[model samples]
Target: MFTGLSAFPLTPVTDHGIDEESFAGLVQRLAAARVDSITALGSTGSYPYLDRAERARAARLAVEHAAATPVIVGIGALRTRDVLELAQDAQDAGASGVLLAPVSYQALTADEVFGLYADVTAELSVPLVVYDNPGTTHFTFTDDLYTRIAELPNVASVKIPGVPADPGAAAERVSALRALLPASVTIGVSGDPLAATGLNAGCHAWYSVVAGTLPEPALAITRAASTGDATAATAESERLQPLWELFARHGSLRVVSAIAETLGLLGHPNLTRPLRGLPDHDRAAVTHVVQQLELH
Candidate 1:
């Protein structure tokens, strides 16, 4: 049911706790920009770092700020119960859906992954968007596995990254996946400014971090691409690529979170427990990109 662009609003965490004002501003800006929806607690939100309570609080506040826009919380946890609980919490907080990943610690066989999805889908009332970030999960969903996963009742979409990030290759991958997935299940693309190309290849929507800081430009690119205006979309994407590279340089989470923090946006700069702050060089790189983009 999602289309166009959905900005993954950064979860704001202050040293004390969730920073309501800064966090709200970011969501409100996206809402004002008319982004298709908003996703919270995704990989880019540093989901693994926050405690259960912090995550729920972030979801609740983000939903409130989102107004009529759909709020989908990303549930990436080691425990199925934790994932289910977070999904329930998201539902309770009025989330529109949950984007879930495979179990974190151990890779499961295709059957096991399907069964785990079955468990989570059974417990969640809201729609589930399967998040396939093999880079982090270290497990890629095979075409057959995705076909099976698509049959689950509540599963509505799959978020695949532009892993290799080459326009043509990514398009080929998306096209192949689209052929396998049920028409009802929307395919979402992440990473790279392939929004235009992905849509051309049948991606129903994009989960864009670019939209987080530059909603208008990001959406403009999506709209251009959606309308078959690749020339215009390509131009905007070219402008966005350098900033995206900055994030890529320091890892997605660090650059995205630090960008939010630098802009006086997000709540706390705290990452999940283990991952520390961005190194100074990387932090400066993000600042330079933001400034270069003139993203105020």
Candidate 2:
């Protein structure tokens, strides 16, 4: 099971295609900073925006740069075939695991949700990390359904969006869910700023979008919290709080990509093809937040 702070890098796209050079550089930087894991082509990575070929290239770049560190590939899509295809591609691309969101073509019943998971797991060779980011999928995961999915073969972890407003409560909920899951399975939170607090609350680890832009501070937060230094951890989290707010302030997947572009981490902010960039005002807001954080 992967644990601690795992950063999710933005998948930078140029006018032609995936910017492998920039993407690899970002992954190398994060690895050097000692982030626990990295997710290639995730929500922050703009998985939905990328075509299959681009997603594969991004995953391969992340795996290559991550070296021994675990690299998770986001494999959520509306179609089961697409999800399964991406899952297989991720495995072939050397991803250590895959993160899947429940099918959202329609409002799926719990049984349908469980079946979709089972189908994906059956086709997958690597361990699966189920994602419960309701904000994106428009469907929330019930604890009972998670318990059942955890019992399936190759289901090694669960990824829930950390309730950042009340991390303690989120952590408690994670701990309670852990009890229902198999002892071998890990509980991870996708809430970046709350990672330190979530770990303190018994979450085994976190998959964070903020880590992509600021690996040093993000890993510092993870280390401080994981090692039981609440004072240091809280301070680190506070420092990065400004960046976290950007995710909400700007909204959607575009903001994270925009921040990466402004930082010069990516060659271009062009996401996939049709997705737009941050407006001048929002870009100014993001730039201001970035300057405030002063992450190096």
Candidate 3:
């Protein structure tokens, strides 16, 4: 249930709040494309920026609109109490699994992070993903921690921040993780650009940001890589290098918001306060990249 091409859609919020219409449309589009899974409310979904009520509502909309595809809801919160609440909300909303990042203000020790997952996993009826998102969450996981967490009940996957770019290195990294993790706990690669290398190297899943908006191309890469067509998969990823470059420059969240707006998938200025859209010139660059690449 936690493997392959898990698209993380933007929880496109407007001034009025969670744009149910647009967010639902994004989820529906992903379902239609036959993505392996739809992961709502990841970092790309701006989970940190939303309130509990908005997140619960978005989780419901995602499940309601997701059709037959499995829905995995991001349930990360600064506090364990709130994380547990969101996980319950996700289960109530019919999520196949829940993603948890040890969101923090102060630096969290390995024990603290593990304790967070331990506490939440103990309460979960559904499978839980250990969201090792150091970029946003500012906490990294050691292999020792992964082994310990994998032993927890209902711990299903580890969404690693990324893998090495070189195929050999990626393979080595994945193999090492596989050695530590239980057979049931899948390893999913999160960084979109290295998804090809990771999958080709034997990672079980691609927890993607680009796939959330432009699923076709992301699907193309995933399908190619999973089928053992490593060349085609790498080619497809390279083809979308411009988008990846934009992601590197403006961040995937902002760049994808621009793509969504450019494609008319969502209205402009969809992000919340303190998080703004791309500048006009950067937006124009996104438009050009979209047109040049014939995305959508």
Q: Pick the candidate with the highest lDDT.
A: 3
Candidate 3 lDDT by residue in tens digits, 150-175: 99999999999999998999999999
Task: Tell me the spans in candidate 1 whose CA falls farther than 4 Å from its real position.
Answer: 163-169, 266-273
Pairs in steric clash, model 3:
none
TM-score of 2: 0.93
What residue runs in model 3 are displaced by over 4 Å at the alpha carbon? Answer: none
lDDT of each: 0.79, 0.81, 0.93
203: Cα error in model 1, Å: 1.2
Candidate 2, residue 24: lDDT: 90
Q: Across residues 184-219, which tens digit of lDDT does each residue of candidate 2 receive?
A: 889887766567777777777778877876778877
RMSD of each: 2.1, 1.8, 0.7
Model 2 Cα shift for residue 179 (angstroms): 1.5
Clashes of each: 7, 0, 0
Which one is best on TM-score?
3
How big is the positional error of residue 241 in model 2, measured in Å on the Cα after superposition?
2.6
Q: How do the predictions measure up, each by TM-score?
A: 0.91, 0.93, 0.99
lDDT assessment of candidate 3: 0.93
